[model samples]
Target: MRIETLGINHSAQEFLAEQNITKLYPPQADAVKAGLLEGQNILVAAPTASGKTLIAMLAMMEFLSTKQGKIVYLTPLRALASEKFSEFKKMEKLDFGRRIKAAISTGDFDSVDKESENADIVVLTNEKMDSLIRHGAEWVDKIGLVIADEVHLIGDKDRGPTLEVVLTKLKELPAKPQIVGLSATITNSNELAEWLGCKLVSSDWRPVPLAEGVFDGGTILWNNGDSDEIESSIRGPPIDLCLDTIKKGGQSLVFAETRTRSASLAAKGSDAVFKFLSDSEKKYLEEISQKILDNNEHTDLIKTLSSLLKKGVGFHHAGLNQNCREIVETEFRNGKIKLLASTPTLAAGVNLPARRVIISSIVRYDVKAGANKPISILEYKQLCGRAGRPQYDKFGEAIIVGNANSSDLTEYYINGTPEPIESQLADDKALRIHILSHIVSNPGIKGEEILGFFQKTLAGLQIRKNTLSFSIEIAKKFLLRENLIVQKAERFAATEFGKKVSMLYIDPITAIYFKRGLEAVSENNAHTFGFLHLVSSCEEFFPKFSLRNKDYETLSTLIENKSSELIEPISEYDCNRSLLALHSWISESSEIHLSDNLGIESGDMHRMVETADWLVYCLYELAKLAERADLLEELSTLRKRISYGIKQELVELVQIRGIGRVRARKLYDHGIRTVSDLQQIPVNKLAEIDKIGPTIADNIKSQLKKVR
Candidate 1:
């Protein structure tokens, strides 16, 4: 079917043709026929890469052609938001004659971009949009359409509540924007469509066909009862499958359960990958491998990844830095890398697809359960959906390694339906945070209104109304006890501190934790490790460093020595280790050094620092609220020190934009210690310092001038 037949604008059709996307896939056609172009609400639940994005683009263009209001495209991940932002920004280049401004916002939850407020279309992560709504951005009232990508993540435990509450709140807005939810096929999509008040278009149609099967020994028993014999050239099942796929002229994707396993499998499969690579390919991969190494800190993981990339294999996980992940993804998309092993993070929304996907393990470690649990059928389907890329392969192959439980695997995964997405909004922590946000956003909200708001949620629809009401009451009671909220008669209002807490995007519990820590701190009690422990103990800065046996011994000794100054007696090893890690970081330890000494990945350290910095800022904000002048000065210093990973003396010097820890140390060593010294130093002399280029020197001078 032609894209023009879907009632898209002439310019949009021309743009599609320019990109060689003149024809609509079956799912796109179905969506169009379901009134997607007429500004009607739609739930498009289809396979991955089945023109779902094009469907969204068509709807956006239709809305833009007739409406004056803005369109908000919400994605689940920051990476996906960025990718979609690039795709949507191209619409501005089309000959549509109108200035369709596009903007993207991510990471920062406290502020909304002014450009996005005035944009014709804005792409943002769901959390960013939720934050905007909480802060009561004026432009949200002008929104006429909202496109929620990966709407099925409404079942995710950590992020689902945010997306669900955001959707429910958007629908309840007075503007009543039309919503277009794109999702992978889920079992209860009909119920979801009913909840969203949208017409459903659920289809299994794909741009490229997918063949799913179970591999046991050397044979693949396909879903259709057909069998294929592929002997293993390698010992491991994952490597053998990868080798077989590469021999068939197809790139492979291996999905392991854990980050460790992903790297291990990739390393084990590197030799087999080398056998398949040509000399030219090997040379090109070596260059790419060197680029990866150059872009990252020289850690053991990076060394392993760099070596494996030379053989056309690489491991990808959240542990890798953003630059390394991007390099691997880009190279794989360009067909430079043959096999990539990754955790399920790659299966979520990233557009890196492969010709064949091998599921090395069906089970994942559940931290809360403290055991390995089988992944849901929905997760399995998501991994399988990455098998084929459109316009690249005739068909995709998704093979699950079978074992003694092969029959059950074939029944439950190969032929099974995806599980229904359930609402996780009823979680206590999620409810507490969002409840504060809702009240702070609208201060006059009464208890009844709060109940009504939650009643409109998916969780309210799934569970009993009284159950949700009880949970809301519990959150309200907790907030009142914490003094974050004050109740008068039937109306609930956020206290001044509570309003700031919501605005700062920190959890109410985290705010309470900071308040307690601040109350415990005095001139004699205040210590660096004490404050670090308080920040690490908060729920917002969780999944802290896991304590090894040696770490427990070290932290135990430290805790015994500092028990009087510590916020709480160190009972949890994880919390103590987190403090130790932060201490090392602020003590000017390099990321590579931290990874080697503390067993913390560079990426994890970066995450910890980012979270700790925000929490310290929160502590400073609380100190000011409490009018603790002495504590304020101390926390302000701590915030800067943690933010830059610098010493007390270098804090002021690192305040300049171009001067980080290393540059600050260099400037101090060169007798250019303070801003006054920086003002007296020549730009050329400053540039001559180690790691400081002329551009940075100029930037430092420019920044100093502005400060003066």
Candidate 2:
């Protein structure tokens, strides 16, 4: 179907032409015929590399043609939100005959982000949209179109409930915004579309079809009944298939179960990949390899990744910092990296297609189950969707290396259909957080109205009514017991504490826990380590640390020595690992030292520091609410220390511009501990300090003068 035949506005047609997109894919044509341009809600469940993004853009362009109201785009991950934001920003160049604006909000969950209210389009993560509603973003009523990318996450355990509740809330908005849900192929599309009042346009079609098969040591048993001989290598099965792809002038994306395996296998495959790289390609990769190591914080992961990049392979995971990950992604996209070894997190992210896909393992570590299990068919589909490069390949190959489980892998993952997506909102922990949020946002909301709101949720529709009712009751009891909500005259309202907790986007339980810790810290005049220990207790923000067998004795003795300073005073061995690791961090320990002593790398340490900064701010806000302002001064300093990973003395020095943890440490070692010290010290002497040159010394002098 042609864009012109869809009867979209002239500007949308011209926009499509500029991108050389005249004809629509069959799935996109189905969407157009289903009234996508006429403002009907739609759920597009198609394979990856289909025209889903184009379908979404057409809907948005049609709505923007009227200039009646703004568009809201929601994604599940920050990476996707950024990708969509960058993609939508190009709409400004369209011949809309008027200016178009797009903005993104992903973090800092407390503020209202008034800057984005005027944007014609706002791209956000699911949690950010929920946060905006809680804080009452003024543009809620102005939203005319809401596009949810990765809509299948409504079935995710950690994230599904939030997406479910947010979608329900948006459906009830005054504007009646048209909702466009973009998803991977799932079995429950009809059910989900029914819940959303959407036209379900679901298909398994793709621009580049997949050839899925199982690769034993001897041959690949293709689904089409054709077998291809594979020469096994000591380099491993994944690298073997990857080399096969490279020989065909294509790239390969390999999914491993863990970060360690991702790196290890990438290294195992690097030599084979290196052998295939032309000299020019090797030279192009050498520059990227240097860039990977250039001006970045040295971590064990980065060093290993940089070494692999030079050999035409890369490893990707959450443990690598943003710069390294972006470098890996860009190189792979540019076709410089021949093989990418990654975890499943990348499967659900922005499109990064290769000529072939390989699954090194069909089993993964289920953290909750405490064991390894077979991968779901839906997961296999998601990963296999990355097999082919659209417009570049006629067909993509997805191979699973099955030695003993070859028949089971072929039957279960290749032939089996995806399980229906179910609700995780029936859990008590999920309900309590959102229940307080709904009540706080709509205070004095009656019990029936509140449960009625829950009734509108997907959980309310799919799960048993009686079970959901019981869960809601338990949630309400928890809120009341935790003093997050108060009841009067058959109505419910959030307490000031509850309001703060909800607006800060924290679990009510964490707020209650922090409240007790704040009171104890204020009462006892506890030191800085106490607050670090307290925030470290919340595993949602600061991740849990794994304790080594040798450390139990050391931590036990330290607990004995610092018992008066530790706020919680729970001497359990498992509880203090995060505190101990983070303590080693803020003490100005080197990355290698932290990795050796605490088993935390630079990327993980930095992530913890960033989360600690926010958690510290939360503690500061709650302290004001608790009237424990006495702890405010110390916490203010502690927040800065957490951010820069510095000690108390360098906290003052780090406040100066152009000085980070390293510079401030050098100054502190050189007897310049504060801005006043910089003012009093000679610029020449300050320049003599290690790593601080004359230019920085002069800049510090001028900054002090400005302060004066």
Best-fitting candidate, scored by lDDT: 1
lDDT of each: 0.87, 0.86
- The TM-score of candidate 2 is 0.96
What are the root-mean-square deviations of the candidates from the true structure over C-alphas?
A: 2.0, 2.0
Residue-wise C-alpha lDDT for candidate 2, range 303-385, written one tens digit per residue: 78888999999988877778788888999999999899999889988678999999989889987898999888888999999
Q: Which stretch of 10 consecutive residues in model 1 shows the poorest summed lDDT?
A: 567-576
User: In model 2, what are the clashing residue pairs, if there are any?
Assistant: none
Model 2 misplacement above 4 A: 95-97, 522-524, 680-708
Q: What count of clashes does model 2 give? A: 0
